[model samples]
Target: MQAISYWLKAYGESHQNPINQKIHKVAVPGIFLSVVGLIWSIPQLSLFGFSLNWVWVAAIPALVFYFWLSISVFILMLAYTLACIGFIWSMEILNWPVLPISMLLFGVLWIFQFVGHKIEGKKPSFFEDVQFLLIGPVWVFFKQ
Candidate 1:
């Protein structure tokens, strides 16, 4: 099997428990959104009257990694990134505080993740390899 398939399968091994999978269904998106929000909260740079935030700049490496993994997954990540940008723009327009909200959501969702891992009787895949952190979200997309 290919490297991406191998990594995905290994990641899936620890996530087989139904409850864990269910927990991830919610937690993955929460984590994704929180990361986006947190990053978006950072001060931005304006070029030619357009504001560009770190979130968009930071996504470059991940997008390249995803592209190397698979075109379909790359497309999914692109869509996810665009959606996150839209969310950040909306939050800005609504004058919602981004940092505090992102932190709260990330912390709560991480607690749920730990609880699910406890039920599964396995540590998170990311504990084995940091790259699993990226894999987790893509794995969720693969599940759908």
Candidate 2:
């Protein structure tokens, strides 16, 4: 965990271009929505006699990674839960329309990140390491 934290911090600093910083901010909630929507999309992927929707399980690695790397466990969990609830509500109630809405949100957030990077005159971090993708949301947590 310590090693992961070091890497995350290093990655953030090394790739702290303007675009990444901006993207990290917007992408946090957008990615959260994406994850929740993903889990809720497969309504039958349940466990223990109830629908589990393995997508929700994404929180495990994400939560572990964030707290283990940089952000606090409290904030990470709270954000994850809120995102999950929003996703579930949208999917269960709005149905098919929710997916497009989530996608649009995700897309717009990503564009902002790129624009930030462009302003910074540096390439986006994901170009160097894919793990940076996971690191993006936690970066946003710190910003807040």
Candidate 3:
């Protein structure tokens, strides 16, 4: 964990562009909402008779992509995954609406991000690295 933190901090420093900051501002709430939506969507996933492990599955691409940029991002991704799991378990809510809910959260987060970037007077990190899109969620989640 310390190693991951060190790496993430280093990555944050190196990639501390205005764009990333703006993305973070919006991504935080977006991820929170997305988590809620995921909770809402999980019941349907369970109907398949095998529950899913989101960390190894859904979060892989995001984690791999973050590790490429910084260990901090990987750590953040880890935290985000754990948080999502906790949220779902605590709420005991699940259904098929999670897909659209996640999308809606993403869209809202994106809009907030754009607004943040506009305020920062910079472009989004995605302009430099598309993977930053994935990182934005973790960055936002950890900030809280």
lDDT (Cα, 0-100) at 97 in candidate 2: 67
**Residue-level lDDT tens digits of model 2 in 42-77:** 555656778665664766676666666545644676
Candidate 1 matches the true fold with a TM-score of: 0.92
Q: Where does model 3 exceed 4 Å of error?
A: 1-23, 32-55, 65-73, 89-97, 137-144
Q: Write the per-residue lDDT of candidate 1 for residues 17-102, one digit (tens) a residue.
A: 99999999999988988999998888998999998888978899988888988898889989988897798779889999888999
Better of 1 and 3 by TM-score: 1
Model 1, residue 92: C-alpha shift (Å): 1.2
TM-score of each: 0.92, 0.69, 0.54
lDDT of 3 by residue, 1-144 (tens): 224354335335434557657567657656655755564455434435787644345556656766775676667666766677566545445434456757777678768766766766667666765554554565455543
**Model number with the top TM-score:** 1
Q: Cα deviation of 141 in candidate 3 (Å)? A: 7.1
* Stretch of 10 with least lDDT, candidate 3: 1-10
Q: Which candidate's lDDT is highest?
A: 1
Q: What is the C-alpha local distance difference test score of candidate 3?
A: 0.58
